[model samples]
Structure formats: structure tokens, C-alpha cells
Target: MSTDAHPTPEGAQSGRGRAPDTEWRSWHARRLETITAPYGPLSLTGTHWLDDHPDGRIPAVPGVWVQDGEEIVLTAAAADGLTHDGELLSGSVRLTAHHGPIPESPLAHGDRRLVVLRREGLRAVRDFDPHAAARSAFQGIEATPYDPRWALPGRFRPYPEQLSVRVRSADGRERGLGLSGEVVFAYDGAERTLRAVVEGDGSLGIVFADATSGDTSYRFRFLRPFAPAADGTVTVDLNRALLPPCAFAGHFICPFPPPGNTLGFAVPAGERRLIGG
Candidate 1:
């Protein structure tokens, strides 16, 4: 944690202020609760792709899942103990990729949610169970305390058109990383930038690596700056850097850092790794 308050540049202090330590601690607690929730990432036990299992029978999950055009056709017997909307499913139900939260998923087996997920035209089913070993052996996250130096003023420069770059995911599969803009800021007396994606809620999402990566922190972390002002000014707060979902579960396919998103300087703030086990 840095105690020195570096001078906040003019015009940058207008709508942004360093968050109090209490607030950051509260946020961290909430994050822990979210990730450990019943249907959170940590509860994901398996992701079975329909294409990979041509037999339609998924391991552990008691259903025959087959891709039927854009939707997934799930056939279940009463003995399978599968339910949809609290009623035991006796026949079949056509399921499309759930665009909502895991708990809202229509398919359930006891307390587990069988969520249909689609990635690049490939469909899959994710089994989330509250009793997953990863959730049971739960540990807290390790993070550095709030540091004002990691909070810098930045400007968003949107590209004339959206662009994408090929990057490898945590699953070792290459995928396209879409970029909507670049966030330019000053760090360590030098100008630096990161390619950013505009999230659905209009926030800026960035996946980056810093000098501390793979040493004191995870190999990569995520940063989400609030939407930029009309003048393109935004606060780049690295103190809120986050571990990608893959850090919590291997089933998640989180994208790796794209080109030029790796910083040369060490950032000792934000979430590092899971504590305990």
C-alpha cells in the first residue's frame, strides 16, 4: 500500500476521487460472496460441449443433450431426476443458450443448474453445483491495499471502427479479442496504454499483464474503468484490478492479454491469488 498522495492532475479530479479503504474492503467482501455463491464460477464442475460428446450423454449429468439447429434438445427420463420450473421433466425440452444469470436457468438437477452456453456456434452445458470441491475448500483472495499511485487519469480513444485480435484463452484455445478503443494514461512518469473492450453496460474492460504478473500476482488481471465522460476522460484505477474467472475455475475460458496490453511497470495493488487452499 502506497501512502504518498501523488498530485492529481488538473481537470482529472473533477468527477473522480480515490476510494476510501473502507469502501475497497467492502467491495472485496462482496466480490468474495459473489464468487462463492451457489451458482458462481467456483461452483462450475464441468463444461461439456455437445460437439465433443456425439453420444449425447454427458458425464455425471443425467440427460441426453443434442444440438438441434440453434437450440439444444435435452431429453430426460423421469428417473433422471431432472426438473424444469420445479416440475420433473418426463419428456424433452428445447433449450437455447441462457442469456441470464445461472440461478435463472430453467434446467436444474437438485441444486445444480444445467446452463446451456454457446461459444462461436459451438454449444455446451455447464454444470454448477453448490457442493463442488472448489467451493467447499474455499479460500479468500489475496490483494494489496489501496494505493493512490495506481489510480491515474486516462483518456479513451475509440477506434473509428471496432477491431479484433487473435489471442489465446486460458483453455489454450485461440479466439478473437474484440477491441473498441484504447485507454491512454501516464504511469511511472511515462505514457502507457491498453486496448479496451466496451462492455455491455458501457464500462471499459481491459485484460492486462504487468511486471508483477506471475510473481507477486496472477499472470493476468482485469480492470474495468467506468464509462468515459463526453470529453473521453476516465479514471484508470488499477487498485481494483481483478483476477479473471479462470483464476477461480478451470472450466471458464477466459481470454489472455492481447498484444501491447502488458505493462512494463510493476503494479503491486489489487487482487493477487486465492488464499489458503
Candidate 2:
């Protein structure tokens, strides 16, 4: 997770020689398990930006969260039924900006985790409750089975300097999304490019859309490309493309595709939508 922003996702890796179908099945099953977990994306109920509520009272959430310069002041009285680091918390506590695994977060209300996050100098609190309706009703993600044709080869061209561009988020607010380079490749006899961002682990993150978006698939999806090889050659495997967090929960402010990140053709492979529509 980002100290100043929320992180993306997790997936399983396979050995180089593993059968594609078997590996894909394993990966898909794990993905389902992860999303249905206690604090997974489907369990997220809300992300209340503190700036939206000057009084520090977030809807359906307990605690008074106010931003003070570089920190978030969370005043949870005994009646709030909140805890910090496992002990019942009373009075007020100052919190630093961080968003990661729910268990690692310092604040909680019973089975729900209160994730304090700060992005671009803005603060927010994400509520992750195990009993969220979406998680309980989740059947699985509707993904196309592994198909060799959907996996394409590409080359990573890094920029001389990283740049940040403001893009609209799912929450209807514009936030700066860092773009470090582009992934160029041939798809169906046409050359295409996707804006790429450098992830914390040195991998490339692609948030994009295609013709199928908003019709067959979610509005946008994420493709996590492994760190480039020394020669800059990499595989732009769409078979492993993932549905962004916002697909599971509306509260997630997942960023939309940056300019030029939308593919013109339909991409029928990869995760389409969550089960049960």
C-alpha cells in the first residue's frame, strides 16, 4: 500500500514451464479467494474523504477524523466502540498517512477495519467490514479462460523523466497519476501503446479500457506487467489482466484510463466482471 495512496492488487505467479491452463485456473481460484476475504475489495463499504466533511463525522462510520497539517486526528470516544493496536482506544490519537492490509492498520471497529489514507495532501478513511453485502453475495469473477492469442509480446520504453498528470478518479475527483513510460506492441497487425506507471516493486501498472469496456467488461481494467527484462523486452499478457478495485466496490476511487490508454479494439479475454452481475 502507499503511505500517501492506496495500493492495487495481488495475484499468483507460476513457474515458466507450468501449463498455461492449469496455472491460470490456480491463479483464478486464488483471486476469488482473495477478493472474498474479510478485508478484501468486496468488503470495502466506503472511502470518506475528510475534506468532504469539515465536521469530521463520516457517514455510517464511527469516529471523528480531522486532518491537521501532516497528520489525521482521530478522536474515538469509548462509546465509539473503536480500538487502536488491539487495545480499547479512548480520547484522541494522531495518525500518520498509510493504507495497506487491514490487519496492519492500527484502527478497527469490531470486525471492520478503518484504513486511514492520505493522497495528494488529501485525507480519507476507508471502511472495510467483513460483513459487507458485496462480499457475502460474491460468487466469483467472470473471466475468460486462458487463451494463447490474448497474450502478446511488447517492449517497455522508459521515459527520461517520470511525469504526473491529473486524471479523474472513480470518486469524481481529479488526482495526479504518475506516468513513467509507455508499453508499445503489435495487436492484430496494429501498433498500440499504453501509458505505464512504475509500481513500488519496479513492475509496470497499466490502467486501461478497450472496446469491450462498459459493455462486456468493466469500464477499465488493470494489467500488471512484470519488471522488464534487462533488454527491455516483456510480455504484455492480457490473459492475466485484472478488474480494478472499483469493479468490486463503488467506494473505491480507482483512477480511470489516462489519455491514450484506451485500446480501440475489443479485448474479450481477461477478467470481465464480477459474478452475479
Candidate 3:
């Protein structure tokens, strides 16, 4: 069967390959809206460190926040309209920077939510407001129509063990990039493979580019294939290639593709670039 006929399961449609003409255009329109959403990466105004405020009070955030051991203590009043653990919490509550999804976050103060964060040994708070200017300016994501030619079957070859390599960040910082293995696949009669990292949820995230990158699209695009099977085989579908967080939020520390991840041919499919520059 063709990749477009990959079959849509019961609840969710198959996210692989190109959508039919009607659905394909609709998906492209929605993609633009998602990338340009209010809380999207572009609107990040500040990332405040708790250490910066010795007194534990962040400016513009209506609460008294202090670090207590591994948790952060937030003190607010009923008038502050803060909610925590499903209750309109007043006084104080201890919180840890949530490692889970943003929708389930427990700490909120009216339109603003205090998101605890940790990087290295440093602790900080992320403030999310629905009224953020970025959210308002969002139009939508720019993506190319899904094409089966970009979808290809691939095999996963594991290394001896997990390997960590250092790469320079867009922010001029060096960080560790971990690799589990390489995903080898064929596209346009050419065999190609890319080094990828396995997400905690078992998805495969690859940073790559083709001859079209830097000219047709951004310097690089991201591809997230579903988790591999027990035998270590997965689909390296370029149809669903994506843009990195750095493309949205400047504060994000995104890793660059290693030397070998770049494909020599132009793979002109999926999200090409954002609109309006």
C-alpha cells in the first residue's frame, strides 16, 4: 500500500504521509496558527532566575516566591486569585518545577502562572500569561503539503551504547547532545541515515536538512517519527518534518544536527518556512 494509505486508526487519523487535497490545505492553515499562538515560542519575554531576586519576589508576578529545599514556596492571598492543586490556594504552597505537560501545571495566579524550572544547578520561574503579545501576534505555521515521496521506511541501528556529543548552541553556549542510534532509510532511490535522539516517550526526533535548507526553508528542520518496534525498525517520514523550538522561541536551547545528519539532496517537503518573515 502507498504511504498515504497508511491507514487511520480508530481515534486518530494516520499522521504519516500527505493528506488528501482538502485535508492537506486545512492542515497547512492550522499549522500556521499553532506556531504563531500567543504562548508560542516567539512571545517569551523573560526567564527570571530565583537567585536574581534574593528576596524571592519576582517583579510583575503577584506572589512571594522563595526556594525551600528542592521545592519552591509561593505565598499569595485570596485576592491574588492563585490556584494550586485544584484549589483556590491562599497563603502558601510548595511546588517543584513540573516536568510534565504545561496543561497540567498546578501553579497559577489569575492570568499569570508561575512555572518552576531548573537547568543545571540553577532554578528559575517561567511566567505564562494568556495576554502575552506573542500569543496575539501569532498567525500560523508555514508548511508544505504532505507528499508520500517524503515518507520512507527506515531501520534503526543502535550503537554500542548511549553516546553523548558536545555541540554549540545558537545562544553561543555548548551543551551535550545524546544519540541512541542512526535511522537508515531510502528516499528518491538514495539511501540516507540520520543520527537521532529517542524522546522519553519513545518518539524519534531527528535534526536534519537537505540541499533545500537555508534557501528554501530554514537552515534545518526537525523530523519526529513514531517509536520504533521491538525489532528496531521505524518510518523516517519526511512529510512530517518540523521546525525546532529555536525557530519559535529564542530562549530555547536547541541542538544543531551533527555533521552527518545533513542530506546531500534537496528534500523539499513538509514545513518550509514561516510566513511574513
Candidate 4:
């Protein structure tokens, strides 16, 4: 089994002095728990698009899911053993896009969730089973100890107008990824910048790749710097950088980093790769 001492970054300064080791360790533990939880990323087995199956019959998924205007109509039979809200559903239910967590999905067969979703006017259903092989085979995530050099002060420079760029998703389809602005910081004694996406909570989300990408680390990683202060100052803590959802599940359609988001230098800190088969 691969193991890291999980040492704390003693001098990871962000104008808040040293980064708290215990807090980071606790966050790491919770992250592990969240990813391996039932119906989490590892449990996602398939994402079947409704358009791909004109007959509304998806393999291994018991139900007829068809797009009717902006809503999805899911017709289920009692024989399918489908339930909604803890009650057996024997008829149809109008389901719109699911914007919440997977566990709260509207339809289920025993412990498996049939999550209906829509993206860019396309509809689909994701089947998440706790007994998925990926979940059972997951061992651990290889990560490097935190280092202060990766956690630096950065400035968010918002664009005069928000922009959307089409990028290739992990599923090899093109999708629009909205960009709010850019975050600039110093690395290798030179100014480095990355385009930022404003998350639902107004925090700045950075999708980036580095020299270590495709080798030591995953193809890409994510860093979320909280909403800037009054002066547009935010801490770019790569120590807390996260592996993308696609890293854990093949069904996820994680987008590639926007143009110029790849750093030129190697960043040896943060999550690297999956540990076991």
C-alpha cells in the first residue's frame, strides 16, 4: 500500500501565518470520505444520454426516460423495483435537470441511483451503484506533503465582460466553459497567471496543468481560491489542489483547462494519482 506521512506545511503562509496542519489533515480525511461514499464519483458506472437511445430504453437501466420539452419524463413500472422518496413508483414522474447531489436523485433501484440530468439542452441519466467495481478497487490517493511555495497570494482581475470558451470534455465532446477573469501570482520569480471560473459561491476556480501533469499527477488539477477580499486579494493555495472528478470516474465530463492555464514549471506538491487498482 502506498502511504504518505501526510506532513503539514509548516510555513505555508497566506497572510495568515503558518497553515494549520490539523485543519488540513481533517479536510483531507473528509475529502477521502466524501469521494468514496456511496453514490460518490467512484460509484458512477454509466452516463447514458437520452438522445443516443431513441426508444427510451437504456441498457441496464429500468425505465423509459424521454425528453419532453425542458423536462424529462421517467415512466417506471413496479416490476422495475424503482422507488422515489422511499415509496415504490409504478407510473411516470416529470423530472427536470438534477442540480443537487447524487444521493438525492429522484429515482432509485434498491441502493442504486438513476440520476436524470440536463446539460446544454441535452438530457441523460447517470447510474450510480455502490457495488461498482471502481469503488471496490479504490485503494488511496497519492499526494505530496503541503509546501508554502505553492500557496501564494494572488490577485483576481475580472474581465470587463464574462466570456465563454468551448473546450473538450473528458468525454471528448466540446462544451462551453465560462470564464470570469484571471488570477495572477508569482512563480519562479516571474508573474504567472491562470484564467478563473466563478463558482456558484463566487469563489474563483482554477483548472490547470503543470509539468508534472500526465506523468506524476493527473492530467489536470483544480484549485479553488475563495472570493477575493475588498481589494481583490485571494490566496492561491495549490497545496489544497484537487484531482478532477474525471480522475475518479470515467463517466464524468470534466473539461480541459482553458488556454494558457498550463504552468511552465513543475509543481511537485498536491494530489498526484490513484494508488491501487
lDDT of each: 0.81, 0.83, 0.68, 0.78
* Tens digits of per-residue lDDT for model 3, 109-152: 66565668875556778766667766666555567777766668
Q: Cα lDDT for residue 129, model 1?
A: 95
Using lDDT as the yardstick, the better of models 1 and 4 is 1
What ranges in model 2 sit over 4 Å off?
1-9, 12-15
Query: Which numbered prediction scores highest in lDDT against the true structure?
Result: 2
Clashing pairs for model 4 are none
TM-scores for all candidates? 0.92, 0.94, 0.76, 0.91
Query: Which should have the higher lDDT, number 3 or number 4?
Result: 4
Clashing pairs in 3: 31-141, 32-140, 32-141, 33-140, 36-138, 38-135
Candidate 1 vs candidate 3, lDDT winner: 1
Candidate 2 lDDT over residue span 1-277, tens digit each: 2411223455524345788778778878877877888888888898888998999998788888889998998888898899999988899999986645676888889998888877888888888899999987888889999999977889999999998888898888898888889999998899999988777777788889999999989888888777888888878888888888888889888888899999999999989988778
The lDDT ranking, best first, is 2, 1, 4, 3
Each model's total of backbone clashes: 0, 0, 6, 0
2 or 4: which has the higher TM-score? 2
TM-score for candidate 1: 0.92
Model 3 spans > 4 angstroms off? 1-44, 51-55, 75-82, 86-90, 187-190
Which 10-residue span in candidate 2 carries the lowest summed lDDT? 1-10
